[model samples]
Target: MLPDISVVLTTYNQGKFIKKAIDSILSQSFNNFELIIVDDGSIDDTKRKIDQYSDSRIKKVFKQNEGPSSASNVGISLAKGAWIALMSGDDISLPDRLQVQYEFANSFNYKICFGLPIIIDDEDNIIPDEDFPVFFSDHSFSNRKVFKRLFEKGNYFCAPTAFFQKDIIEEKNPFLISSLQLQDFACWLSLSKKYDMPIINKRLIKYRRHANNISSKNNNGRMEFEMKMIYKNILNNMTWELLHEIFPNQFSVASMNDKRCFEIEKSFLLLKQSIKSVHEVGCEKIWNYINDDVMCSILSTKYNFNYLDFFMETGKFNTNERDESND
Candidate 1:
């Protein structure tokens, strides 16, 4: 019989915590599921530890050290369930994670579901739950207001805590497996366009923030990659009219520089989309664009432009001159 859900986990050099990750899944309150773990070329004893688990529900695929994006793509491709709960090898999910998301998706008919994540340090100490901003139940998910909120800040949806319908990803083909970083944000931006974003509002996953994480080590590089992804995949695809309606904060020259970086990224994706014949203008890009310059500027500056204000005011195009102040 087919399982009710599929848990897709990707790992690289996670031997230290892979056991905890796997055990958490096995001990889940929701038992009727399959666990697909992709060991993305670990040179360590991660494989040996995985071998220690012999449950029939666990399936392991070994691949060369590709990246999380590729590993996840492979996992999703092999998933037989209608829903896939994305997880990481270094993190632990709450026992009720799948059960809660499954019930919410079933009752609400949500295509994608996200949740609040508890941040934990390498020593497994709770850092602070307030990393995620306080959210109201009536927050906008189906309209531009939602995208506006996301652009106003960084990613609000914790990737591992989120579960999505396999079919939604299959249909969009939005993920580019070649990218080793920012894959989660790229995928979420695409999903936001086609479906109403759902938040589980529960702390379902422990997001382990440690020095060993690939993201922590090459943060600047990852930010560069994310900026490139946004420009190619999201900004250029949006028409000036739609962008004005949805991402007005990007109008200023300075903001436009930021938007232009996204535009360049979108431009790249547009070229590929047209070439591949997967072209369709989304309602809005639905994702914020970032570039190396913008990323650095963001490091120096306090925040990006205000989305709601940018939407209402068209003349507020941020001039590129202001970026000089950053230098």
Candidate 2:
């Protein structure tokens, strides 16, 4: 019989924490979930450790060296459950996690659900308040507008805490196979375009941070550049959407190239003149394009335009030059 949920726990060389991760899932209060562990060519003893688990619900697949994106896609393709939960081999799920999420998803009929995670060290000890990163404090997943703004600023959800229906995974092709560093972020952005990913509001997973983690290895300037690229793609899409809504007649007649070359002056004027209408259309508190300096820098550096010009042109802010300051 198929299970109610399929928990896809992807691992690289997390042999030290693999057993605990699997144990946490097996001990979940919600029992009808299959645990599929996809080992992405770990050079360590991760496979041997997984073999020690005799639980009939645990399904292990050993694949050749591939990144987490590919490994996750493999597990997703094999998932037979109605709901799919993503976890990392180094993370620990709270006992009531699956149950709470399952009920929440069913109650709201939401296709995607995610929650905040408690940061833990390699030794499984919770990090101190000062040391713990405050990632999602300002974001509200329940508010679609707030969530979209948060996503534009940066990825706020932890991948291991995400739970969604299998249909989203199949329909969206959620993970970008080529993205090595920000694949989860890319997936979340893709899903947000068409679905509402509500936050569970409870901490349901222990996210382990260690030296060997993929994120730790790639947390450099280049990662920021890649993230900016992702944000630009999202911005371009939003711009087109805004234009299509505000200038329906012109948008309908414009060629693709003409649309791309369309002056930001017109877009800015439309936004300034119809801010209320834009907000009513669900883009409440659109900050990134207006006030975010980092986003402005990305726009200036890549698209070769000064974002502050809009503020100056609209007399919104008394500034002569683009404020190059970033938060």
Q: What would the per-residue lDDT of candidate 2 be over residues 156-225, giving only the tens digit for each residue? A: 6778998999887644356777667678877776776667777777889998888454334235434544
**Relative to the unseen true structure, what is the C-alpha lDDT of residue 248 in candidate 1, on a scale of 0 to 100?**
54
Span of 10 residues, lowest total lDDT, candidate 2: 318-327
Model-by-model lDDT, in order?
A: 0.66, 0.69
Superposed Cα RMSD, model 1? 10.7
Q: Highest lDDT, which number?
A: 2
Show model 2 residue runs off by greater than 4 Å: 129-133, 170-173, 211-218, 235-327
Angstrom error at residue 177, model 1 = 2.6
- What lDDT score is found at residue 160 in candidate 1? 84
TM-score of each: 0.71, 0.73
